[model samples]
Target: MTADTSVRFREFKMPDVGEGLTEAEILSWYVKPGDTVTDGQVVCEVETAKAAVELPIPYDGVVHELRFGEGTTVDVGTSIITIDVAPGSGPAEEPAAAEPPAASVPTPTAPAEEAEEKPKGRQPVLVGYGVAESSTKRRPRKQAAPSPEQSAAAAIQAEMNGHGAAPAAPQDRTRPLAKPPVRKLAKDLGIDLATVTPTGPDGIITREDVHAAAAPAPAPAAEAVPAPAPAPEAALVTAGARETRVPIKGVRKATAAAMVGSAFTAPHVTEFVTVDVTRTMKLVEELKADKDMAGLRVNPLLLIAKALLVAIRRNPEVNAAWDEAAQEIVLKHYVNLGIAAATPRGLIVPNIKDAQDKTLPELASALGDLVATAREGKTTPAAMQGGTVTITNVGVFGVDTGTPILNPGESAILAVGAIKLQPWVHKGKIKPRQVTTLALSFDHRLVDGELGSKVLADIAAVLEQPKRLITWA
Candidate 1:
């Protein structure tokens, strides 16, 4: 057998792991160059904006090259690896044979543009697939005709303004190159893509470029004009060299954007109640020893979650979402209970599907699996979607309570405070009892103050009595 071999490299581009997610950060690689790999073998794990997922190579081949390193964030449709499917099939003396086929390979843009003409079968999924075809076509924006003299004047003005030559006429330049996610982001930030500088590979505008464009530029210092005074000591934090700046991307970035949108877009009203949860705490201990829930997670949170579900059952309207676009209140017949969990990546709310129907032990098991998966960064993007309502247990951190923010698209969120033994008047006697504060934050657009108060009261009532779960539910 000859030691010399010819290489046939097949490039595998990054796929859209989630709906409209433009990019993913390569967390780790499982296969290296020269390693033998079979079809459906996982080659790497990448973290998208939603969740971390393992990507499998769809074809059998030897790993040829890794285009990007670990921790590198790659735009969707960009090639991240190449595999030599026909490794050692040709002799070294026939190296010229490989060159012709390599040269014949079409550019990524051509295949994407012509994909609709191709007879579509079962397209390869995950990592190995190219970009998915858009179902609808967009007509290019009409550009006004410009005279040669006007164009010359514009170019001269652009150069005088230190912007270099004016940008090519709209008809002369191809549409700004950006992926769907980047385009969506630019839209959300109210930025015109043409005005933003492209810093990505091959003149593609990236999320960072959009964000940079969205940020307010510093005012040019002038000797004739006095600078505005700095605001206060609190605002001076940005002036220090000790500050650490973290680039927001992935899950953290998504969370931050979602929270900001939720805060400003939704009218939030929070109702708080301090109640004696002595009975609830006792029930939690009893459930921990129960044979049915022997191995299941039985904590104050489990009971708190059950209580919130009961409250939603009594006030079913509070489980609804406000549809701003449709101008209607969407009443959910089923409840997907989101539990706010702080993970190393960021805060994630992975909900239990159809949680209102689950038994106590079943709900406990579901909660246990959800938490375990989130902590391990294995929660799927689907797991975090379609939540009707949410519960945030700040109590676990020994905090009193918090005005929890409603998760985007959800109507309400319940925040549980620390359970502590405190002196309280019970049966007209001052004695120590387990007490906790519960704060319910809801969107006032759908849930009014009266409805919000009723829900909060019902939750407190459940914890106080600990028997209402059966009666109310």
Candidate 2:
């Protein structure tokens, strides 16, 4: 019996790990061809626009082949790997030789058992992402026979191009091998997919290939007769090496898009206040030594966060989002407090869910976990969503203050500056006091000047007098 008659192959497509994510770049592969894998085993780590996610194989199998290599950005719903489920029955067939020049057109061939058991709706592949409906509905393209004259011309052209013979005309290819997203991209750029050459695995057109096609062709020189001139040693060494170019993707790319959208969409109104945080600093030290907060990460940021929460509680209207589609102000009853942390990948704000209900000790623990996970690059996409308000501390970098932008869909963001012992007015006299500046940027469309001012004032008051946390709450 042949290998195909005994072996069963299953192809795993790239999943949309994050909500509405169209693509992901494979960061690394844990298993390769011929490696035995179990159900729920993580086979590859991929970096989506939101965060890095590990994809787990849904069933036990021996790896048949990996379609794409590491660092390849594959579209969601495109098959990335093939697995041989019944490898023990017989030798697995090599699929590379059977692949067509246009790889986008996949044949709808599945094991009889799989076809019978296939779900009507989407099938779950990864834990959270279900297989797209279109992934399993591929149909073979119908090839039209070429005329005798066309075949003769192709033969002549192939010979003249140094090839002895050719099977089909270059223009005889069926539909261009591109995923739906790639097709849409080409359509948006006004570039025909037929004019682009595919470099993706199995000769499928990629997003890069489309962009390359869309780029304007350089003008041909009218008269090119001059010979090359010798360059100086310094010029030769430094020519075309002035700048370093880095491809923006993953979390950095997401952050950039979000920031741009938030900046432009939201009507920003920033209010600043320099306050004496002497009591807040003292409270932080006391909390660190307290038995209730033992073994927890307690710092000035914790107290600052607590202070901000108390302020929001006092001015509940400030904790809301403007819904453009509905044309309404959506006031949030519960707070998901976002804390901005700078990581190697980029700046990410992972919020604590229902933060308004967490106790001081619980808040400290949550903050600790959030910071630790972010530093290790283990933060998930879910952790970064649904934030009502955000706080960014530039104090760690010894910066005074900055007007922080609001996180998209959120109403306000607070910026905390460095706390330094400076000369200040205390009890009608100049004295060395711990002071810091706070800047609050809010969506002016919903939060008015009075509402924004009250929120900022309340936070400043809480920091100046540590007892107000208990008093205000």
Candidate 3:
């Protein structure tokens, strides 16, 4: 019998995961050159415009090469990995020809049964099946080869050697060199990479180098160039006009398009209600001093988040999506509470799933982790999906109030204004107390004005008197 043979080389490119994202930064590579990979095997981790995503191999084969190294930013449709599918090998193969059709050749159905009954050499495709259609699941820790510290050390060593490492190489670029994470930190802070002086043992860039870069640069010497003779009045002398052009990339670009789209598409109706949050603020102070809540970042937002969860339980209509295709209003029982954070990469709303089930301390920890991940641009795509409702804290920016647009899909969004001490009439007497405004914006189609107003009032009532949360719960 002849040996079945056919070699196919398949190139795997990064796909636009979602949210109209264009480019992504490679976080780590799972398979190295020359390794055998299976279909649906995670090849690398990437950070898109919204969250971190894992890219899987589409076919099983020997990995020919990785096009981009960790920390390199690659555009969509760019080939990231190559696989060689060698013919007639692995667990799959063809069967031997049988004798004259016996009762329809018994319709030889099962591959395993045929293999056992006949002695035919069969070859299967490298990856048994195609890539999984669902989003890649994240392992608790990535299975990539190099540890973060090792990658950092190697990067430093390469930098010291004078020759720059190939941009696609994944060996740690951080050396007595700067680490990739640190380099990322610098980039997010607008620190110039070249100007950051290394401070490590081998003159490698260190965390300190990045921190130093974030510091304000020393003022340049006030060199007095002999002043050019003053231009004559009305002489059409240009005042040394200069225009600076900043390239739109990363966070800035993503935020701009989302804001414009949400603003126009959603019929936004922002209604504000002032609340006396003195009790909520007092609870924050108590939680801050509690020994059990040691590491948690307890703040007014935690209480507000809890209040929102309770209000949502009473008003499920606010937590829903408008499905235009199905022409139905989809209601959700579980809450994925999105917290709108003003990160260096513009504004991002990464949510906490099943937030209603978490205790106050648990909510505090979740908020802390979400903020840290968003700030580092490491929020994963899953975290950004299935958000039922959103909260934007303009108060953080010291602004009293703002009208926020509803997140795409979700029917409602709540904005918390800055909390300040103000003289207000309390129980018929004017007194100084902690006061803030709560603004609720809802989709006129899914959530009516009455429902939106009720939700906003319920949240305010909880903040106005912290004990209401317990009763509602």
Candidate 4:
């Protein structure tokens, strides 16, 4: 074969993947330079706005190089991997040519076709489509040979001698049976997986088992590290002049400016209310089993969302925004409920549009969809706009409550707290009940204390007796 026909260097560029996302953060590199890879082999993992995706290589060849390092943000259409492709030859190279753009390259062979045609048990290259299709034709089943008991005396004697020969030295049976990744996790967590009883199927060690075994033992005060020593004469090179700088970029910069603007310009006032949400917790449990709410994530946030919508109807002032230029309170008839989700990127408050129009089941589904999309980083800019009020679920992070800063153009924000079972007075008898705290922060100029309290109390009352939601509706 001619040189051009024998070998070709195929460049694999990062695709949009989906959701029209322009950029992604490189989470990891599965292959490095000089590593031989096959089509459909996973080359790296990229974190998009919505989810972590494993990017597969599109060609069969040795990985020439990874253009971007882990944690580096790369734009779509950037060349991520180069593969030296050769026909028949195990490894080969070709003379350099002017690089072609990613869009000009033809689609590589599908992973399913390659898998069925390739030899059994061979690891495929990183390039190409993922997930091979199953074969349609089934091979004929094989029959086993007759047992030694059915054979002659000489055959029985031979079998007995084979069994008696050393017995495989009692192979290290104490060591746990785990995959390489699980074993790596155990090592990283300082866990002795062998000693940790396996709960996985077939007595295999799992990631959770490793984590549980590696849990740090609580220590007394005596074992705690002491405070750092005072600075020495040489270390005090510039006393009272020490400073550290951090670049304000991405989420940190955006959050900082928003916090400052909200605090200084919005005239904020925060009020706290503790509520017995036992009924709400019980209702959540019931909804989780409900056929109507199937596949929806039933949680306190859903109830809180419903309560907030109801309270907004009762006290519309809480949802009203301050219009400085117009010198008016922009009262919204419909609620666009904003949910503040803390993602890998930072604090992103994406909202549900016209949330007041949704029923309980519809709201639950919307919340589920919203959360799933947000976590995957697929929440559109339009979904994040026109929010009248917001709810920040600090409870997910185990925080009891915090005074949340208002999203720009919104009037109020609510912080949901962690729910815990605590002893409470029920009809003069002490009973264990699920309780939670709610912190409401509002622009004082638009919302008075009476209005804020009423809004909060209305939400608490619904949570205290979730059945009230039906009656209130």
Candidate 1 global TM-score: 0.68
Give candidate 1's total backbone clashes.
Answer: 0
Write down the TM-score of every candidate: 0.68, 0.71, 0.64, 0.54
- Give the whole-model CA lDDT for all candidates, comma-separated: 0.75, 0.77, 0.69, 0.69
1 or 2, greater by TM-score: 2
Tens digits of per-residue lDDT for model 4, 55-102: 778787655445555445678887766676753343233223445545
lDDT of 1 by residue, 1-473 (tens): 64333435566789998888999987766654445677888888888998888888987876655666555688888777767677656422322344322432232221112212222332222233343322222223246788999889988999998988858532322245565456546644546666779998657789999889868752221111011242344422232247544568889999999999999999999989999999988888888888989889889888888888898888899989888788888999999999999986799999999999999999999999999999877898989989999999998899999998889999999998999999999999999999999999999989999999999999899999989888876
Candidate 4: 10-residue stretch with minimal lDDT: 218-227
Q: Which segments of model 3 are wrong by more than 4 Å?
A: 1-45, 52-77, 81-176, 181-197, 207-241
Which portions of model 4 miss their true places by more than 4 Å? 1-247
Judging by lDDT, tell me the better candidate of 1 and 4: 1
lDDT of 1 at 58: 81
Clashes of each: 0, 0, 20, 17
lDDT of 1: 0.75
Residues 1-473, candidate 3: write the lDDT tens digits: 43232335565777998756778877655554445677778777686767666677879766544555555577777666656565334422222121121231122111221113221232121212222222111112225698989888877887788756533433322112344466556644545555677767545567778787667653221111111243244422222335323446555676677778777877778899999998899999998999999999889999999999989998887888888789888989889999988765567788999998899889999999998888766677778888889999999989999888888878889999999999998889999999999999998888888999999999999999889888988
